[model samples]
Target chain A: MKLKNEQEQKVKAGRYGKNFGGQYVPETLMTELEKVNKVFNELKDDAAFKAELHELLNNYANRPSLLYYAKNMTEDLGGAKIYLKREDLNHTGAHKINNVIGQVLLAKHLGKKRLICETGAGQHGVATATIATLMGMECEVFMGEEDTKRQRLNVYRMNLLGAKVKAVTTGSRVLKDAVNAALQDWASRSEDTFYVMGSAVGPAPFPEMVKHFQSVISKESKKQLQEQAGRLPDMVVACVGGGSNAIGSFAAYIQDPTVKLVGVEAAGKGVQTDKTAATIERGTVGIFHGMKSMFMQNEDGQINPVYSISAGLDYPGVGPEHAALAECNRAQYVGITDDEAVAAFDYIAKEEGIVAAIESCHAVAYVQKIAPTMAKDQIIICTLSGRGDKDVASIAKYKGVQIDE
Target chain B: MSNLAQIFKNQKVFIPFIVADDPDFETTVKNITALAKGGADIVELGIPFSDPVADGAVIQQADLRAFEAGVTTQTVFEIVAAARKETDVPLVFLTYLNIVFKYGYARFLKKCQQLGVSGLVIPDLPYENRDEIVPLAAKYDVDIIPLITPTSGQRIQKIAKAASGFIYVVSSVGITGERDSFFAGLSNLVAEIKEYTDVPTAIGFGIHTAQQAAEMAKIADGVIIGSAIVDIVAKEKTNAPQALEKYTQEICTALRTKVEQ
Candidate 1:
């Protein structure tokens, strides 16, 4: 009887709270997921793995990314002080390297010879390709045909890094379709390849695994904030696409009820318009892409083709953990329009001399709203998850100024 | 006895799978009647999903065509209701979990009972997560048909022990597709599964030809053919019902011929 109850409990082990994230995959991959889950559980706490991973982070990816006071914007807002967790300073120019380094090591430990990745705006693709080159593993990336057309430079970077990039033209030919293509590839190649998910979405262990690797962002920033400001910030803000960076930014402070966590989702034009990717705001509870979460799908459960000016934040769903966080009222999610995000993208670069990724600018846009309302003593730490170098050309195009390809 | 028990009463079963409303509703009902005329012991109706990650290019295209025709969940249910008037072969739905989930488990299962859909082949709904739907499925007299793959290993006993109707034994290492070869030790895998349950097992994925069907029939109690039929539907779009029936006849005739030998 005890064994039976334990087995039943095991079925619910990978879930977040009560309603999100189970291994909703084919039977062949279910066994493989179980194997990966078991390995991840063991290595997440192992001292040898930690030492090796820290060595790579410190030496290769240039760990301990800066926590800078955005003094110009802080004074201009004339209300709360603002600090930026500058993940943009990482070697790969994004927080994605943190998760990539960890998954690559885990895959290597499992004797995986090849790596698969799916990318939207291509920061994650570049990070995966960069690490695969460093680790001497074969790598392939699936990007949507539309994304490849926009983010051509990163395509070249992945190619230069010795990874094959395939343009997926299925579905709406965007991030979701790219994920679908990678999933199909992973389903077939689970024997010799490890799928390095770029975000905290997809099946279980992936959500937890990506968060575990990215928790470094919170761990560093929380300590740095304490040193600089003498206390935890009153609010933590990060942009949500598939929400890897947001989850990482919130992980360390989740237990502190006083620390308010906010996730800014990209609303392409406006939530009132059909063109929006604000999943947490307009989504219903449904399952897609291997995890049960809030999805912007039709009533019939067909996933909607979502839109966002920043390709990285264009997914129709948020991560399962984010869904649960919103459900249990641990985190509050809000939307930022494309216009607002673009204006903030320009403002952050001009004010702080920091070109934040358009995805991260959503958080900055939200800050431009609420930062002016709070008291001067309260602090807000916004995670600058990626540098805006890749998005500069697209931003120019969106502003009716085109540069040569 | 239920239609599921009736299918495996005496002979080796031949199952053919096709997406409902690939072209339109009237044609889907017609295709069902033709498949029954072609000696299908059971018919698996795929409820087309926008993202069919577990399927290869053929069925994926079929799903796209269904959506292009504006096929909705209600359209699929209506097609099944229309097909029921023409044939009484056990109807099973091959759907993703989200579709049934969005429709609500209780609501979807009640519809299944009403439509005479005896079983559900949800590829994503594994035995570990079966309890979420199994009790509901049982309440409505619907079998949540469980899948056991070549890689299931020791977990096969745990899954098979609770299975009803039949066990979908995936013959290959990956998603459903046409393959010239199957995973090694599939026969031994089937033998191992039989040690735990009285439920019949059907070998699916990659069995495209009559020769392949006869070969697979030697190992398992049933053989399921899908992608080949879906590919044919893609090839003969307007004439899919007749083409599907003729192809089903070929697969059925070969299985009986091999049995007589």
Candidate 2:
């Protein structure tokens, strides 16, 4: 079937869903971003690119994760039906492989021999290291010293993958600090090294390109939803850290005006409280990680330190495009407190036998509040961005309960 | 026409380079006006960025001093705007690309235009990056001046052709500092850039003495002195404005000597 006129114009106009995606960076880097974007656009329909990506996705990442419906949770919510995308079944155990495959290929195309990335939860860092190892490119990951201590197993896993993980001690000693260190490294060694940002943020082509890579999530979800139920979901909810998973799940659905998009941010205590990473709710516009975006910052323009029980959601800023979406009212920003997120994790696990990552639990908590009030047929898809396996210790600690196993 | 541009077109153009808010804000304003009074066609005000990797120690130290004096991007703009009201000499701001990019390219240009700035000299903005700026400059009536060095080859002509105003021909590849002799290679470089375009060229970087300015004035359209004038002002404990007038007169008189001889 032919796409509608507005749809065709929207695709051709390249609004990319508002003025959110464009080259806003240093003149030197803007040149490179434009070059990469041009190449990526031309190769979008190239059969070879698709085939190459597919080969890696299947043989390497073990693609085509099962789509399972949570019937028990659907009954408990007493509203819209929910289905899991099962990205947690990927080889690295998350959807990060999708982006890593795309970026590693892009690096090879760009003739770069080294890959650098920053990670807070260590999932993106490990995924990047995994791809770099497979591609035989030198890999380096910058993580906050505190995060290195918190996510030690993932640190070990990255080291085992032969990627050197550098502990960043500057700034707030968290994700934003790690990003600062990574950017500093990239600036000095930009000629030979490609900085693979883990999320849809940073200057320009990064936010756009990373979103494109991860859009496969929503693309697959759309088809899965069509097969399961003859229509699209009314709302799509996901957690926003640097907003990788949120961008992934929401990118394909952005043009659908009927679909309400909700981005759940980690309000450590609450939006009004001191401890939080709710950049959209609490932040002002500023530069961080080489991009101009809404960020929690002090009067001197330094990024204010943020706190969240979930390391993944402890960043001081969200993606610039996400900020734009909120501004345009195309997307709504909601904050989930740490305690409520913890309760949602227990609620989902006990009710549906689905233990969600602390970051993903924010989305789960949003669904718990929003789903009950919706009509029976009004569907809500909560993106299970990651599994809870990494957060088992945190969950145990939160409940004052210890896991012997 | 801006008084600076008017004076530039009137006769043999005279320009003096100084880092803004150097030593302190008070000295900066005094030095700028002194240079203007001493027949300076225009003053090239340098906005110091945290990382000035391209500059030499003298200019770098001047930049550091300016920054230490609590000079910020907005502060520099505010100083220029205030200076514009008092002096007819049009101010040309020199800076790196990062500051402009951070301030938003369109907004920065708009602000400069509003502040009555006649030109801009960004060392990092290459020929390719001139697409957006070239048009914006025309719209705002601000000239985007391109810098060339003694090492400029065929690309010098391309840069000169792309240039909206005069070309800033560096005396050497190195940063701004005081030097005794103006090398023959520099004159040859200026002559080479001149062969391709008719735009006036100003020779700068490492030029210190009267003989050096005289030598530069022999080959280039104008001679620019930065570090020497800045160093004198930085050294004197008092009467910086008077010292600036004395030094600028000395340099201008030296250039005039070369013109007559």
Candidate 3:
């Protein structure tokens, strides 16, 4: 496959279908980002690269996870049939590993010596650390100090994988600050460093690249659903942070107009309150983290400090593609409050015996509210993005269970 | 003559940047007068943004301090307008794109024009997306300055062609901070930009001390000192205006030295 020039790639990846994405980055990082884009463009069509990536995904990270039908929950709701796309069963215990493995392999192919990334819940950091350890590369992860405190086990997990986790204290001491710190690190050492962007956010190639890697989830679910349920699901749902899993789960179904896509955001207290990360519901168009996206910001254009029970969904900005999707009405984004998400966390554990991350519970919480309204023959597939083991301590504290960390 | 052209006409231009309302708006106003009196040809007044990804630690902290001091877009503009009453020094806003976008592009530029601001230096607004904000700036007679970095490669020519006022040549690969040494190809990068446009090219980022100013002035038409000046404001607190004036005087003196032919 012939690689297009940098300008052509920018046109395709920088904005949404018509407008919304572009590489609005400092000049120092442009060359490196463009280089990665060029290589990724060629490798996407290269059969050898595809074969190797598939081998790694299958043999290492365990692709084609089960599409389990939640019969009890479906029967209880008495409306839509609910199916869980069990991404929580993947290696590293999350859907994050899928994108990390692809980017880590691409970094190796590009001959980068170091891997750097920013994480909110430490899922992406742990996944990146796991891959970096396997690939023999130096790894550095920037995590918010607040997040490091909440997700302490994941921090230890990354450290155990031989990755250095730097706690960023600047700004609101959350995911966006971690992103700023990671970009600072990359700016000074971009020559030998590959920034493994954790989600479908940031500059041009990242949103497109991460979606390509995570599209595996929907690809497998599509085939699995057809075989198991004998038809396609009526609606697909996933939680949106920077929107990696949501975009991934919706990628295969985007062209299938019959399948309604829904993205649930973390509404910490409420969207009406300042403590929320429901960017699509409450945010306006602005540029942050190198992408033109819908962001929670002030009239002065400063990014507002956002809050959520799940550290993973505490980002002020949504991915540009999610913004574009929301704009086009292809995907409807709704907010789920923290209290509701906590209830869903417990409800899923009892009803289906499946423990989901607080982040994923946002999607489950939304499904619990809407499933009963649809017809019984209709089906809804939600991406259970990660395991709840990492959130047990936080959830215990939230529920007043008093577990000592 | 336009304020930018006049500032660059006679000698090697020396511009000092300071975040407005660092300690307070009054101190920022005092610093602007001090900077102009200290022989600064132009002054880059930065409006504090919540996230300044293009800057290093020094300026980032300064932004925090300004925000803590209750600096808003309106306050920064009011400070600049106050400074305009005291001096004729060309003032250019060194801010992020989001600030301008939030303030409304045309409105912001019009305010800049009303307050006698000479230009704008938005680090994130690269050449590719200049169309979003440049036309409004041009309408308001505010120069949207272009930046050329060491890795800009062939894009320097394209950026330089559209350059207004002058070109900002970033001397290092990273965000703004003081450095002991710079990229070896900086002179070559400046020369490449020169071939495409006759606009005065001013080198910035990591330019500290009188000797560094003199070294950069040899290759470019001017020099911009930011973090070094911001560092002073961060340390001196209430006395920042007087201290920054002394520092700017020494750097400007060195910048004016003629290169040996």
Candidate 4:
């Protein structure tokens, strides 16, 4: 049963790589997760599934979102030709809708009537609620109690979309705790419920499935960029929370080493301080939220309480695939401080008249940092993963500006 | 490993669980002794982790209390080392994979051997994901107890075939907590597991009362009462030793009555 060196090398590479992504969930959820994997494999290549999914994305969530040429910013930076992949234009105003629509279709095909998910900034919560309403399935979302307060507008949106929001109040009461609540709920009711992981950081089929669905970002941009710009961009940038958007935006270009991929993480105050969410920068190899990924934890393996001004980018771990990519240097990951992201947030909205989500602002901040040093002809595409309206109140609060409640 | 197997011989079994250092380290040591004095066949100690996705509210709160008490892996081991002085009760650490993976596997397992801790019951480390550490666990003579839920289906054979010391048969398809009723045809699945492995199967999850324990032990070799016991600890706090002793004795007396029949 032993293999040759080539096969051995392939064997050494795990589901994501040698060190990430597996089914480390409870045995109670094993059969359900396995069924999801089987169903995904069957439907991924099915022409009918693809056609249905494409139709929904086009007519419902707004597919082929405009890849805008940021002419003003390009001239302002005077370094790289800037392009913004406008995932912000999608229904629910975030790239989260792409994966939501895809997963809801899968849940429908599997004859599941209940949908459960976890959200941080509530983008995923709103997206899941929107899609579940369209599909006429029951939707329940878990959000950190603090996040529910921070993004009350998103909570109301989810509620109006017919999804019940559960405010989680354990273990730092943030995105990770929301994930904990959702997983426990799924473990209790997997027979009739489908757990839609918002990020590409969980165990096996989830990371792969979320990536497969969100890959539409890069799939459309690659073709659109070729027709519009007549050449591939030198770099593609996206923010990494649990890395769904980053992986999706990088999916098409990962194989082409010429097109560099970058994932920007929130550094909170600074990586040197105890208040950073820069997992890839200051994390050890550990397992949590079911995947073996780079996580901020102590020597005793306790998950650290991560902090960020942007609720969307505040998690202790990066996606498993991102960890593997970082390990092999296939993609570059950098951290942005709160001040930098806020500056980018205001600048992008004013300069391009495009309000970018604070999560996506992390990537914008990074692009701003390096764009000035690059050749003007060199192009870089940054994915605006969500519209910034939900973050407007928070940004105002962060800046000590008075806002009416 | 043999010590764990010895507990199932010629009689039905009772395994009581509690979060180590739930209120404090002293209570944990006293609680283990109480369980042993109350006829516990084995004791399952929960090492608190920040995220315990497979545990229900009662046990989750217990973990929070333990963390508030500043429990660490070293503190849990110190509790275990202290308890070993009072009783020879077969002890196992029920924890998440990160707890062990974060602590070097070799070092963790070696420490388990040194402490006479016989097994592990990691809810997250399912059959497919435990390949790398199985041999290392065996090298330390520590049992990596396999879990088979109602949803395990055909995976039961694959898991049970290689399982040793014991098999944890989850009575329902959910996290660890009490339920009004378990899933139907559990005895059939227990029968299926029996066809594949010789290891004793203990039905847990939802078996809270002595009545439930007696009924579940009829189908499997033993019963595991967790959240209910932790609930007692949560309610009684430092005086959990008294409550746990009475509770363990009730379950044991119920199991013994079933054996006599």
Candidate 5:
């Protein structure tokens, strides 16, 4: 199959286009977003800003995370060699810190005094809180009431990091609602607050900016895989909630047609079931949260309340870039059910001794299925976007085991 | 001329916004008629969206109440159509972009045109990116009203030039809600908007009480009060029409006082 050049595809998919993305935001927010976009554009070229960000990523965030060859799983799959990009080892235990660190630095440079963000499973919340505490900025996190209950430990962790966590009870009481609450908060306080969007979603600059910050994952993995595996991987896999980690992992390799980009989505029960977060797999083009992306919405354009075993992957919409990627057929998206993800989580724990986040397990689940179909020499690199510590309680409860924390 | 044009031509306009089917569709129709009878020059009817990022808690709750009451885009259009039979008050829809896009932009605007709905205030569709819906709106002769905020700065002129019906001047740098005071530079913002076009400019966002409405009327062609009226609807529930009418009359009275002065 012929593939459109990644750069050409990006040009065609301008900030907001018919099928992909656009800034569908209120006029009041345009000025604030534009101001952030201005500084962000300058910081992209400013040597000092670049150096500071690099130094911070290297020293503080502990970059150059390992590319561990999962030999046991590779042997078990009996088809392709599997490599795990250990974003789980990053500071704050997830890939979320990469974007958070970049955004927090940008916020400080822009003279923003307060930081606000929304999170689903609390990884982004924890990362933002960690960076905000480090920067001595006032930080607030909006979390859905349902997510707060599921990710209680991370909520406490955020509080311990000196960030106030506000429980949002509106709408579906999930990532989308938290995002709405955070946007509302930003709308009211945009003058003094920097809304550090958690995912590669939202309007212009945000999808681009978050992807840029996260591209570091792919950049590092590309070099590391060349050294570790002696060649670029055949497939790059990551889970897609709002698609930050997947986009981050796929960013560098999108231009390389040889490398197959695979995105895994949560198919709660099944794509046919009402409960699913498989946006790219089962969604139509629509506008929500300031971006025209593929969303699991009703015919009336109202976003559906999606379900997933992993709170982090329980969003109805995917990032605009992911939508564009899917549209251009540069990448393939697959849905993995909750049972499949949980089984993969357990299998990876036993076979690889790595307790993966339930979100990442979706990707791992797809890898297990697809790796068995590929040749032994072919390599698959999956991003373990975060550690599983935050999900242990929920996983335990899923198995009907009570943990008294 | 559109009802909006005629409404803005004569005197200071008092535009009141309410989420259609907040308590119920019948109550919405009654409240809209009440608003018209209470001296509203233009009635801004909101189509409840599941996510309203530009609205604060008050309007958000109103949206939720409407949703729980089983309001849909079709229901809102029907309510407006029903109200049109009873009153000639210019009706404008205040909703998010997704609502219209999902309803099919052409079809939605056509329905608005067919029903005598004069304008649309889609907060999410900024001037730079309105091409998707603007031409269709023009075809339907439904004014796609533009909004200018204090932060708009130089963009005000560009927005004001293309603006139709009336320019909604956001009083402060925030979402809709009652505020004790507006941005200190609001007067200058209004003055800047006037520099480009003669389109009637109305100030909204954070205008609650009659006093605030009266104060805003001093600087612009009109005043829009949303959350305050929604708050009344939220509080009074099924018995909201009387209170909404009374509150609408009070603010209208104040706005007219400014006009008379």
Candidate 6:
């Protein structure tokens, strides 16, 4: 069905529009995609769905997470003042649960009996499986065999939540393999299963749906920053893997062209080496994981395997909207090397008394570099997306150091 | 000598399947030489696409490995252009629609005709989508071979009628995968296809083993084994020319045994 003119324009003008959204998959799942789209559209106006989500956001998720001004750090060298959007305080330790809750709820609304998802760092998978079990729905996750081994604890956590996990063993055995496995499974069982895409990636409705769920971060951050400083932040910073946190935090502020949006990438070794996954800095435009985006690929259209100490940033492709944003120069992307990220990890733990994921440390690391050069009152917000609990061991190994804490 | 139909009617011909950019280009050229030395009458070379939904894991892996090794559409045409000097095997190039679409259909067909390519097997192109290309292909005398799967009912008659050169009857419902009974139910499928048209019917997808090839040869005019032969040719450590000669000899020996019977 064609979208109404107003509705179509509303969707198309968004960061990644209908042209970049929608299913570009095999014919097997056309009927299922249509059904899921129909059910999701129908539930868009259901007050009950909104009411349940509001209550959950308030009670369970700690809604409208505080955007705390970093006065001490801001005053230390003093360029632009820094504010921390404390998304790390959200239930389940990150903004990932926000998306999982919304999608799982949609699955319930669609009468899907089972949910399937693919994850790399396992944060999204755990969040998805947790919500599935919470709703008493069956859940299964396909993770790369390599990732399953590295993220054993997350695999254990998901298994504890009554979700079945399958180790995918194809092509590089990473996020792309997991995606292929999930698509194959979804194709075979599309009638009853809902594939919960982890990031603001994949075919339409998903990129748009995930962006909507994550948009809460920006909405809350804008209001919180306004209330605290009586003005909007001059810039917002977040790390980009699949770009969920960055997209979430920047979506509301995107229309404000003055607000500089910066996304940090894990540039392992350096951009010159094959170890980096910095799409904006080092990648070229290509299609991968069902979206046209910046990918680290060779001329033959095969995605080159990417490496980063942080598994969350070790993906070959970035979100399509991030690609568009970089194209339009609405957002500037900065690449952070492994050594710099490691240093920032230690710096944040010692200075802020907060342990952050290696992925989040990329954002912290960027702030450390640029903070000292800005004006004192120029407010910049950094999204602390997740805590460092999952990255402690890897961070220690990188520094040739061990941390007891 | 003028066309596949005329050539096959007068001679017992060999059609060897070589995946485009298989075992790397240097090795692919060497394998083409081996196929020539092994007395192949015609050669069907396949170009790999990103989403080869009709292929199974082994063939998929070969394609993935080849792509990683830098084999592309342009490289496939280059390989054909290079190999044309080595052998007179009427080169039948098998590819998906996207490659043609990307190359522009008229230009792609014209290029093949210019390159002395004999035929094409675009498996996914149905009769409805064949309108634009068929007339042009006929104009160039490039035989457009169509497939008749077991699942194809009255469509088999239509496919046979529309088809030129030889009719390909898919041995099974699935994509290219190696199996024990590669010719299982193949004889009956061939007989069923033969009733519809006088075009010689060749069986493909799984004609891998010698016994299977021999059984298939008893009834069918030609047997096409792709994924299995490509797998044998692509092993990194093996001498590809030797492997091609060994496999072709085995299949041809089997074909002769059935023919004498």
Give the per-residue lDDT of model 6 (tens digit) for B98-180. 55655667878888888888788876465544674788888887888877765555556666777788877667655677776
Question: Candidate 4, which segments miss by more than 4 Å at Cα?
Answer: A1-14
Candidate 1 residue lDDT tens string, A1-405: 432343244245767755687778888788778888989989989999999999999999988998999999999999899999999989888999999999999899899999999999999999999999998999999999999988988899999999999999888988999999998898787889999999999988798899999999999999999999899999999999999999999989987878999999999999868899999999999988778899999999989999999889999998988998888788999999999999999999999999999999999999999999999999999999999999888889999997886
Task: Report the lDDT of model 6 for residue A87.
Answer: 79
Tens-place lDDT digits, model 6, residues A1-405: 222332345364232523333344443444466576667677756899878877777788887787877776677646888888887787777788888888888888778899999988888888888888888889999999998877777889899989999998777777777877787677656667899988888766677778778999999888888787888888899998888998998899887868999999989989789888887798875545555567786655546788887777888778877877777677899999888988888887887777887888899899998988788778889998887777776666665787653
| Prediction 4 global C-alpha lDDT | 0.90
**Candidate 5 — which residues are off by over 4 angstroms?**
A1-18, B1-3
lDDT of 1 by residue, B102-182 (tens): 999999999999999999999988777899899889989999889998889878989999989898999887788899999
**TM-scores of all predicted structures:** 0.97, 0.70, 0.97, 0.97, 0.97, 0.74
What lDDT tens digits, residue by residue, belong to model 4 across residues B9-119?
Answer: 889989999999999999999999999999999899999988999998888899999999999999999999999999988899999999899899999999999998999
DockQ of prediction 2: 0.09
Q: Please give, for residues B1-261, the per-residue lDDT of candidate 5 as tens digits.
A: 255766777788999999999989889999999998888889999998888888888999998888898888888888988888889888899988988998899999899999998899999998878898898899899999999988787678789998888999999877888899889998888888888888899999988888888889989999999998999899898898888888888988888876797
Residue A256 lDDT, candidate 1, scale 0-100: 82
RMSD of 3: 2.9
Residue-wise C-alpha lDDT for candidate 3, range A171-195, written one tens digit per residue: 9888999999999899888889999
Winner on lDDT between 4 and 6 is 4
Clashing pairs in 5: A16-A21, A16-A22
lDDT of 3 by residue, B1-261 (tens): 135866677799998999999989899999999999999989999998898999998999999999989999999988988888899888899998889988989999999888889799998888888999888788888999988888888788889999888889999988999999999998899888878888898999999889999999999999999999999998899898889889988987788755532
Q: Looking at model 2 chain A, which ten-residue stretch has the lowest summed lDDT?
A: A1-10
Error of 4 at A194 (Å): 0.9
| Cα lDDT tens digits for candidate 2, B1-261 | 122334445455667888888877767777788889987877888887554434555676787688678777778787776676668676788876556655767878888788877788876565644664778777777888878754445467787876666788867543456766544687677777867787788888778887777877878778777877777767872467788788788888887766876
